[model samples]
Target: MKLLVVEDEKKLLENVAAFLERKGFLVDTAQDAEDGLDLALERNYDCIILDVILPGMGGYEFCRFLREEIGSDVPIIIITALGEIDSRIEGLKIGADDYLPKPFDLRELEARVRALIRRNQLRSEPVIRYGPLTYDSRSGVFSCSKKELSLTSRESSILELFLRNPGTVFSREEITDKIWETGFESRSNIVDVYIRYIRRKLEAAGILDIIQTVPRKGYGLRRLRDDG
Candidate 1:
């Protein structure tokens, strides 16, 4: 599993990364929240280990920004010096999966990392099987019961995002952020055209039609069997 360790303490950060790497995990480290957020946004990670005492953007604000602004559901584990009951409660309240205080044992942290990754994988499977359609993320392949259908890069990204957050509304801005990184030229019809591309590809595959528009909200993925 891949994990991102965001901590300002150089020694603790390296130790955590080395320990997790030894435990058979793909580990990445960032010294502050800005770098951490950039990594999280650019690539997918199984879980993020965020330190509370960051230099630029504090961990509390970073967690909230990720949830409310980015619309990411990646599991988060907060590391903090404060072990008070209230502090843990606050971290959980802000959408952190687990918390490890400063001066923690490596073994305990490893266990928590394993648990979080297990839960995260359960939540974000690469290939989703729905009825006769299959969405394969690893190969960027999609298929129906009979034939394979090719998808454009943007189409694949949108479809993958929808499957991960099925039944959840995604704002237009959120979709833009996921697909187009910073400095990409923006156009009005990009999303609409991409939606059309996804529709046409699914239609060609003879897959069940389940993608839907939420009027003013944005695009959402509806499972063929779970249409409401």
Candidate 2:
């Protein structure tokens, strides 16, 4: 799973990121709320660890913007020194999934992150089907023609996005932001490379003409007759 950690204290940010990375998570850190907002909007993450007192935009406002303005349902955990009941209540009211106070135990934080991600995953459909392709989002399995296709984690993620939004052409930048790790070259033709890989696998399964490329837009799943 991937997580975004937004904290101003350099030591805290580094420690948190390092710990999470060691715990087998793709960790991205932001020094302030503005950069955090940008990363939150750009990439998809399993959870966001936010500090309530940020440089430019405050954590509460950032949470409200993502929940109300942008309609993002990504789980957010507000971490700040303010541990009062009112502050916790306010954070939850603004759509934070959980609140952690400063000086928290790293193990507890890890537990909360795992619990939040587990709850979020439970809310989503475990399996998604499109034409002859079947994907178990939880298991990270992609199958066609009753044959399970071996795919890398990134490849499976890209295919899941396409299956979730069939017929909606996604720009290369959008795909990069959603699928690739942070710092990936947005202009690279790697998106095309992955698309070619997916197409080859599907064709090997005797399924073709599923993924379609738009002239300038990028790629999307072709709507099939079996689509209801």
Candidate 3:
């Protein structure tokens, strides 16, 4: 999962990002609301952890912009020092899906994040079906003809991305950017390696040639007529 954390406290930001990264999430950080808004608009995140107290634009306004202007339904967890009931209500009214009071446990935050992501997936696209294969993004599980296919973390993430956007060609660069964090070697053949692994798994499940390689372009999911 990918997450954007907007918090001004340097120590808190680093701790949160590090903890979540250890939990297997790709995390991005912004010290102020301005950077947060820019990152939110520029990239796709599974969830956002926004701070109510920001240097400029604040979290409420940012949340409003994300909902009203950008129409992003991504789940947001508003973190604030103001633990009053009215403050929490205001954050919710501005479109935050959840709230975390200041000085809370990191484990609790992780739990909330996981719950929100799971709920969002269930509400959006719980099971993505392409051809005879079914992918449950929430569980990171893939099945074909009721038989489960084992997949590593990278393979599962890649397969989920492909199944979610059938027919959309993803360049190697795009795949790397979405899957790995910053500083990943651009020329690395990791994407190809994972693609080959996924293909082999599918082939073993009696599914053939679903992931089509677009020569010199990228890879895409082919919708087979007999898939239905």
Q: Tell me, what's the RMSD of every candidate?
A: 13.6, 9.0, 7.4
Residue 38's lDDT within candidate 2 is 93
Best by TM-score: 3
Write the residue-wise lDDT of candidate 3 on 36-124 in tens digits.
99999999999999999999789999999999998999999999999799999999998999999999888789888977986887779
Best by lDDT: 3
Which residue pairs collide, candidate 2?
Answer: none
Q: 2 or 3: which has the higher lDDT?
A: 3
TM-scores for all candidates? 0.55, 0.58, 0.64
Candidate 3 local Cα displacement, residue 201, angstroms: 12
List the candidates ranked by TM-score, beginning with the highest: 3, 2, 1
**Model 1 residue 148 CA deviation in Å:** 27
| Global CA lDDT computed for model 3 | 0.88
lDDT of 2 by residue, 1-228 (tens): 789999999999999999887665789999998999999989999999999998888999999999999999999999989968999999999999999888999878988897788678757868877878898767778898678998888788888778866777888887876676545666578899999998898898988999999998899998787434
Candidate 2 is scored at a TM of 0.58
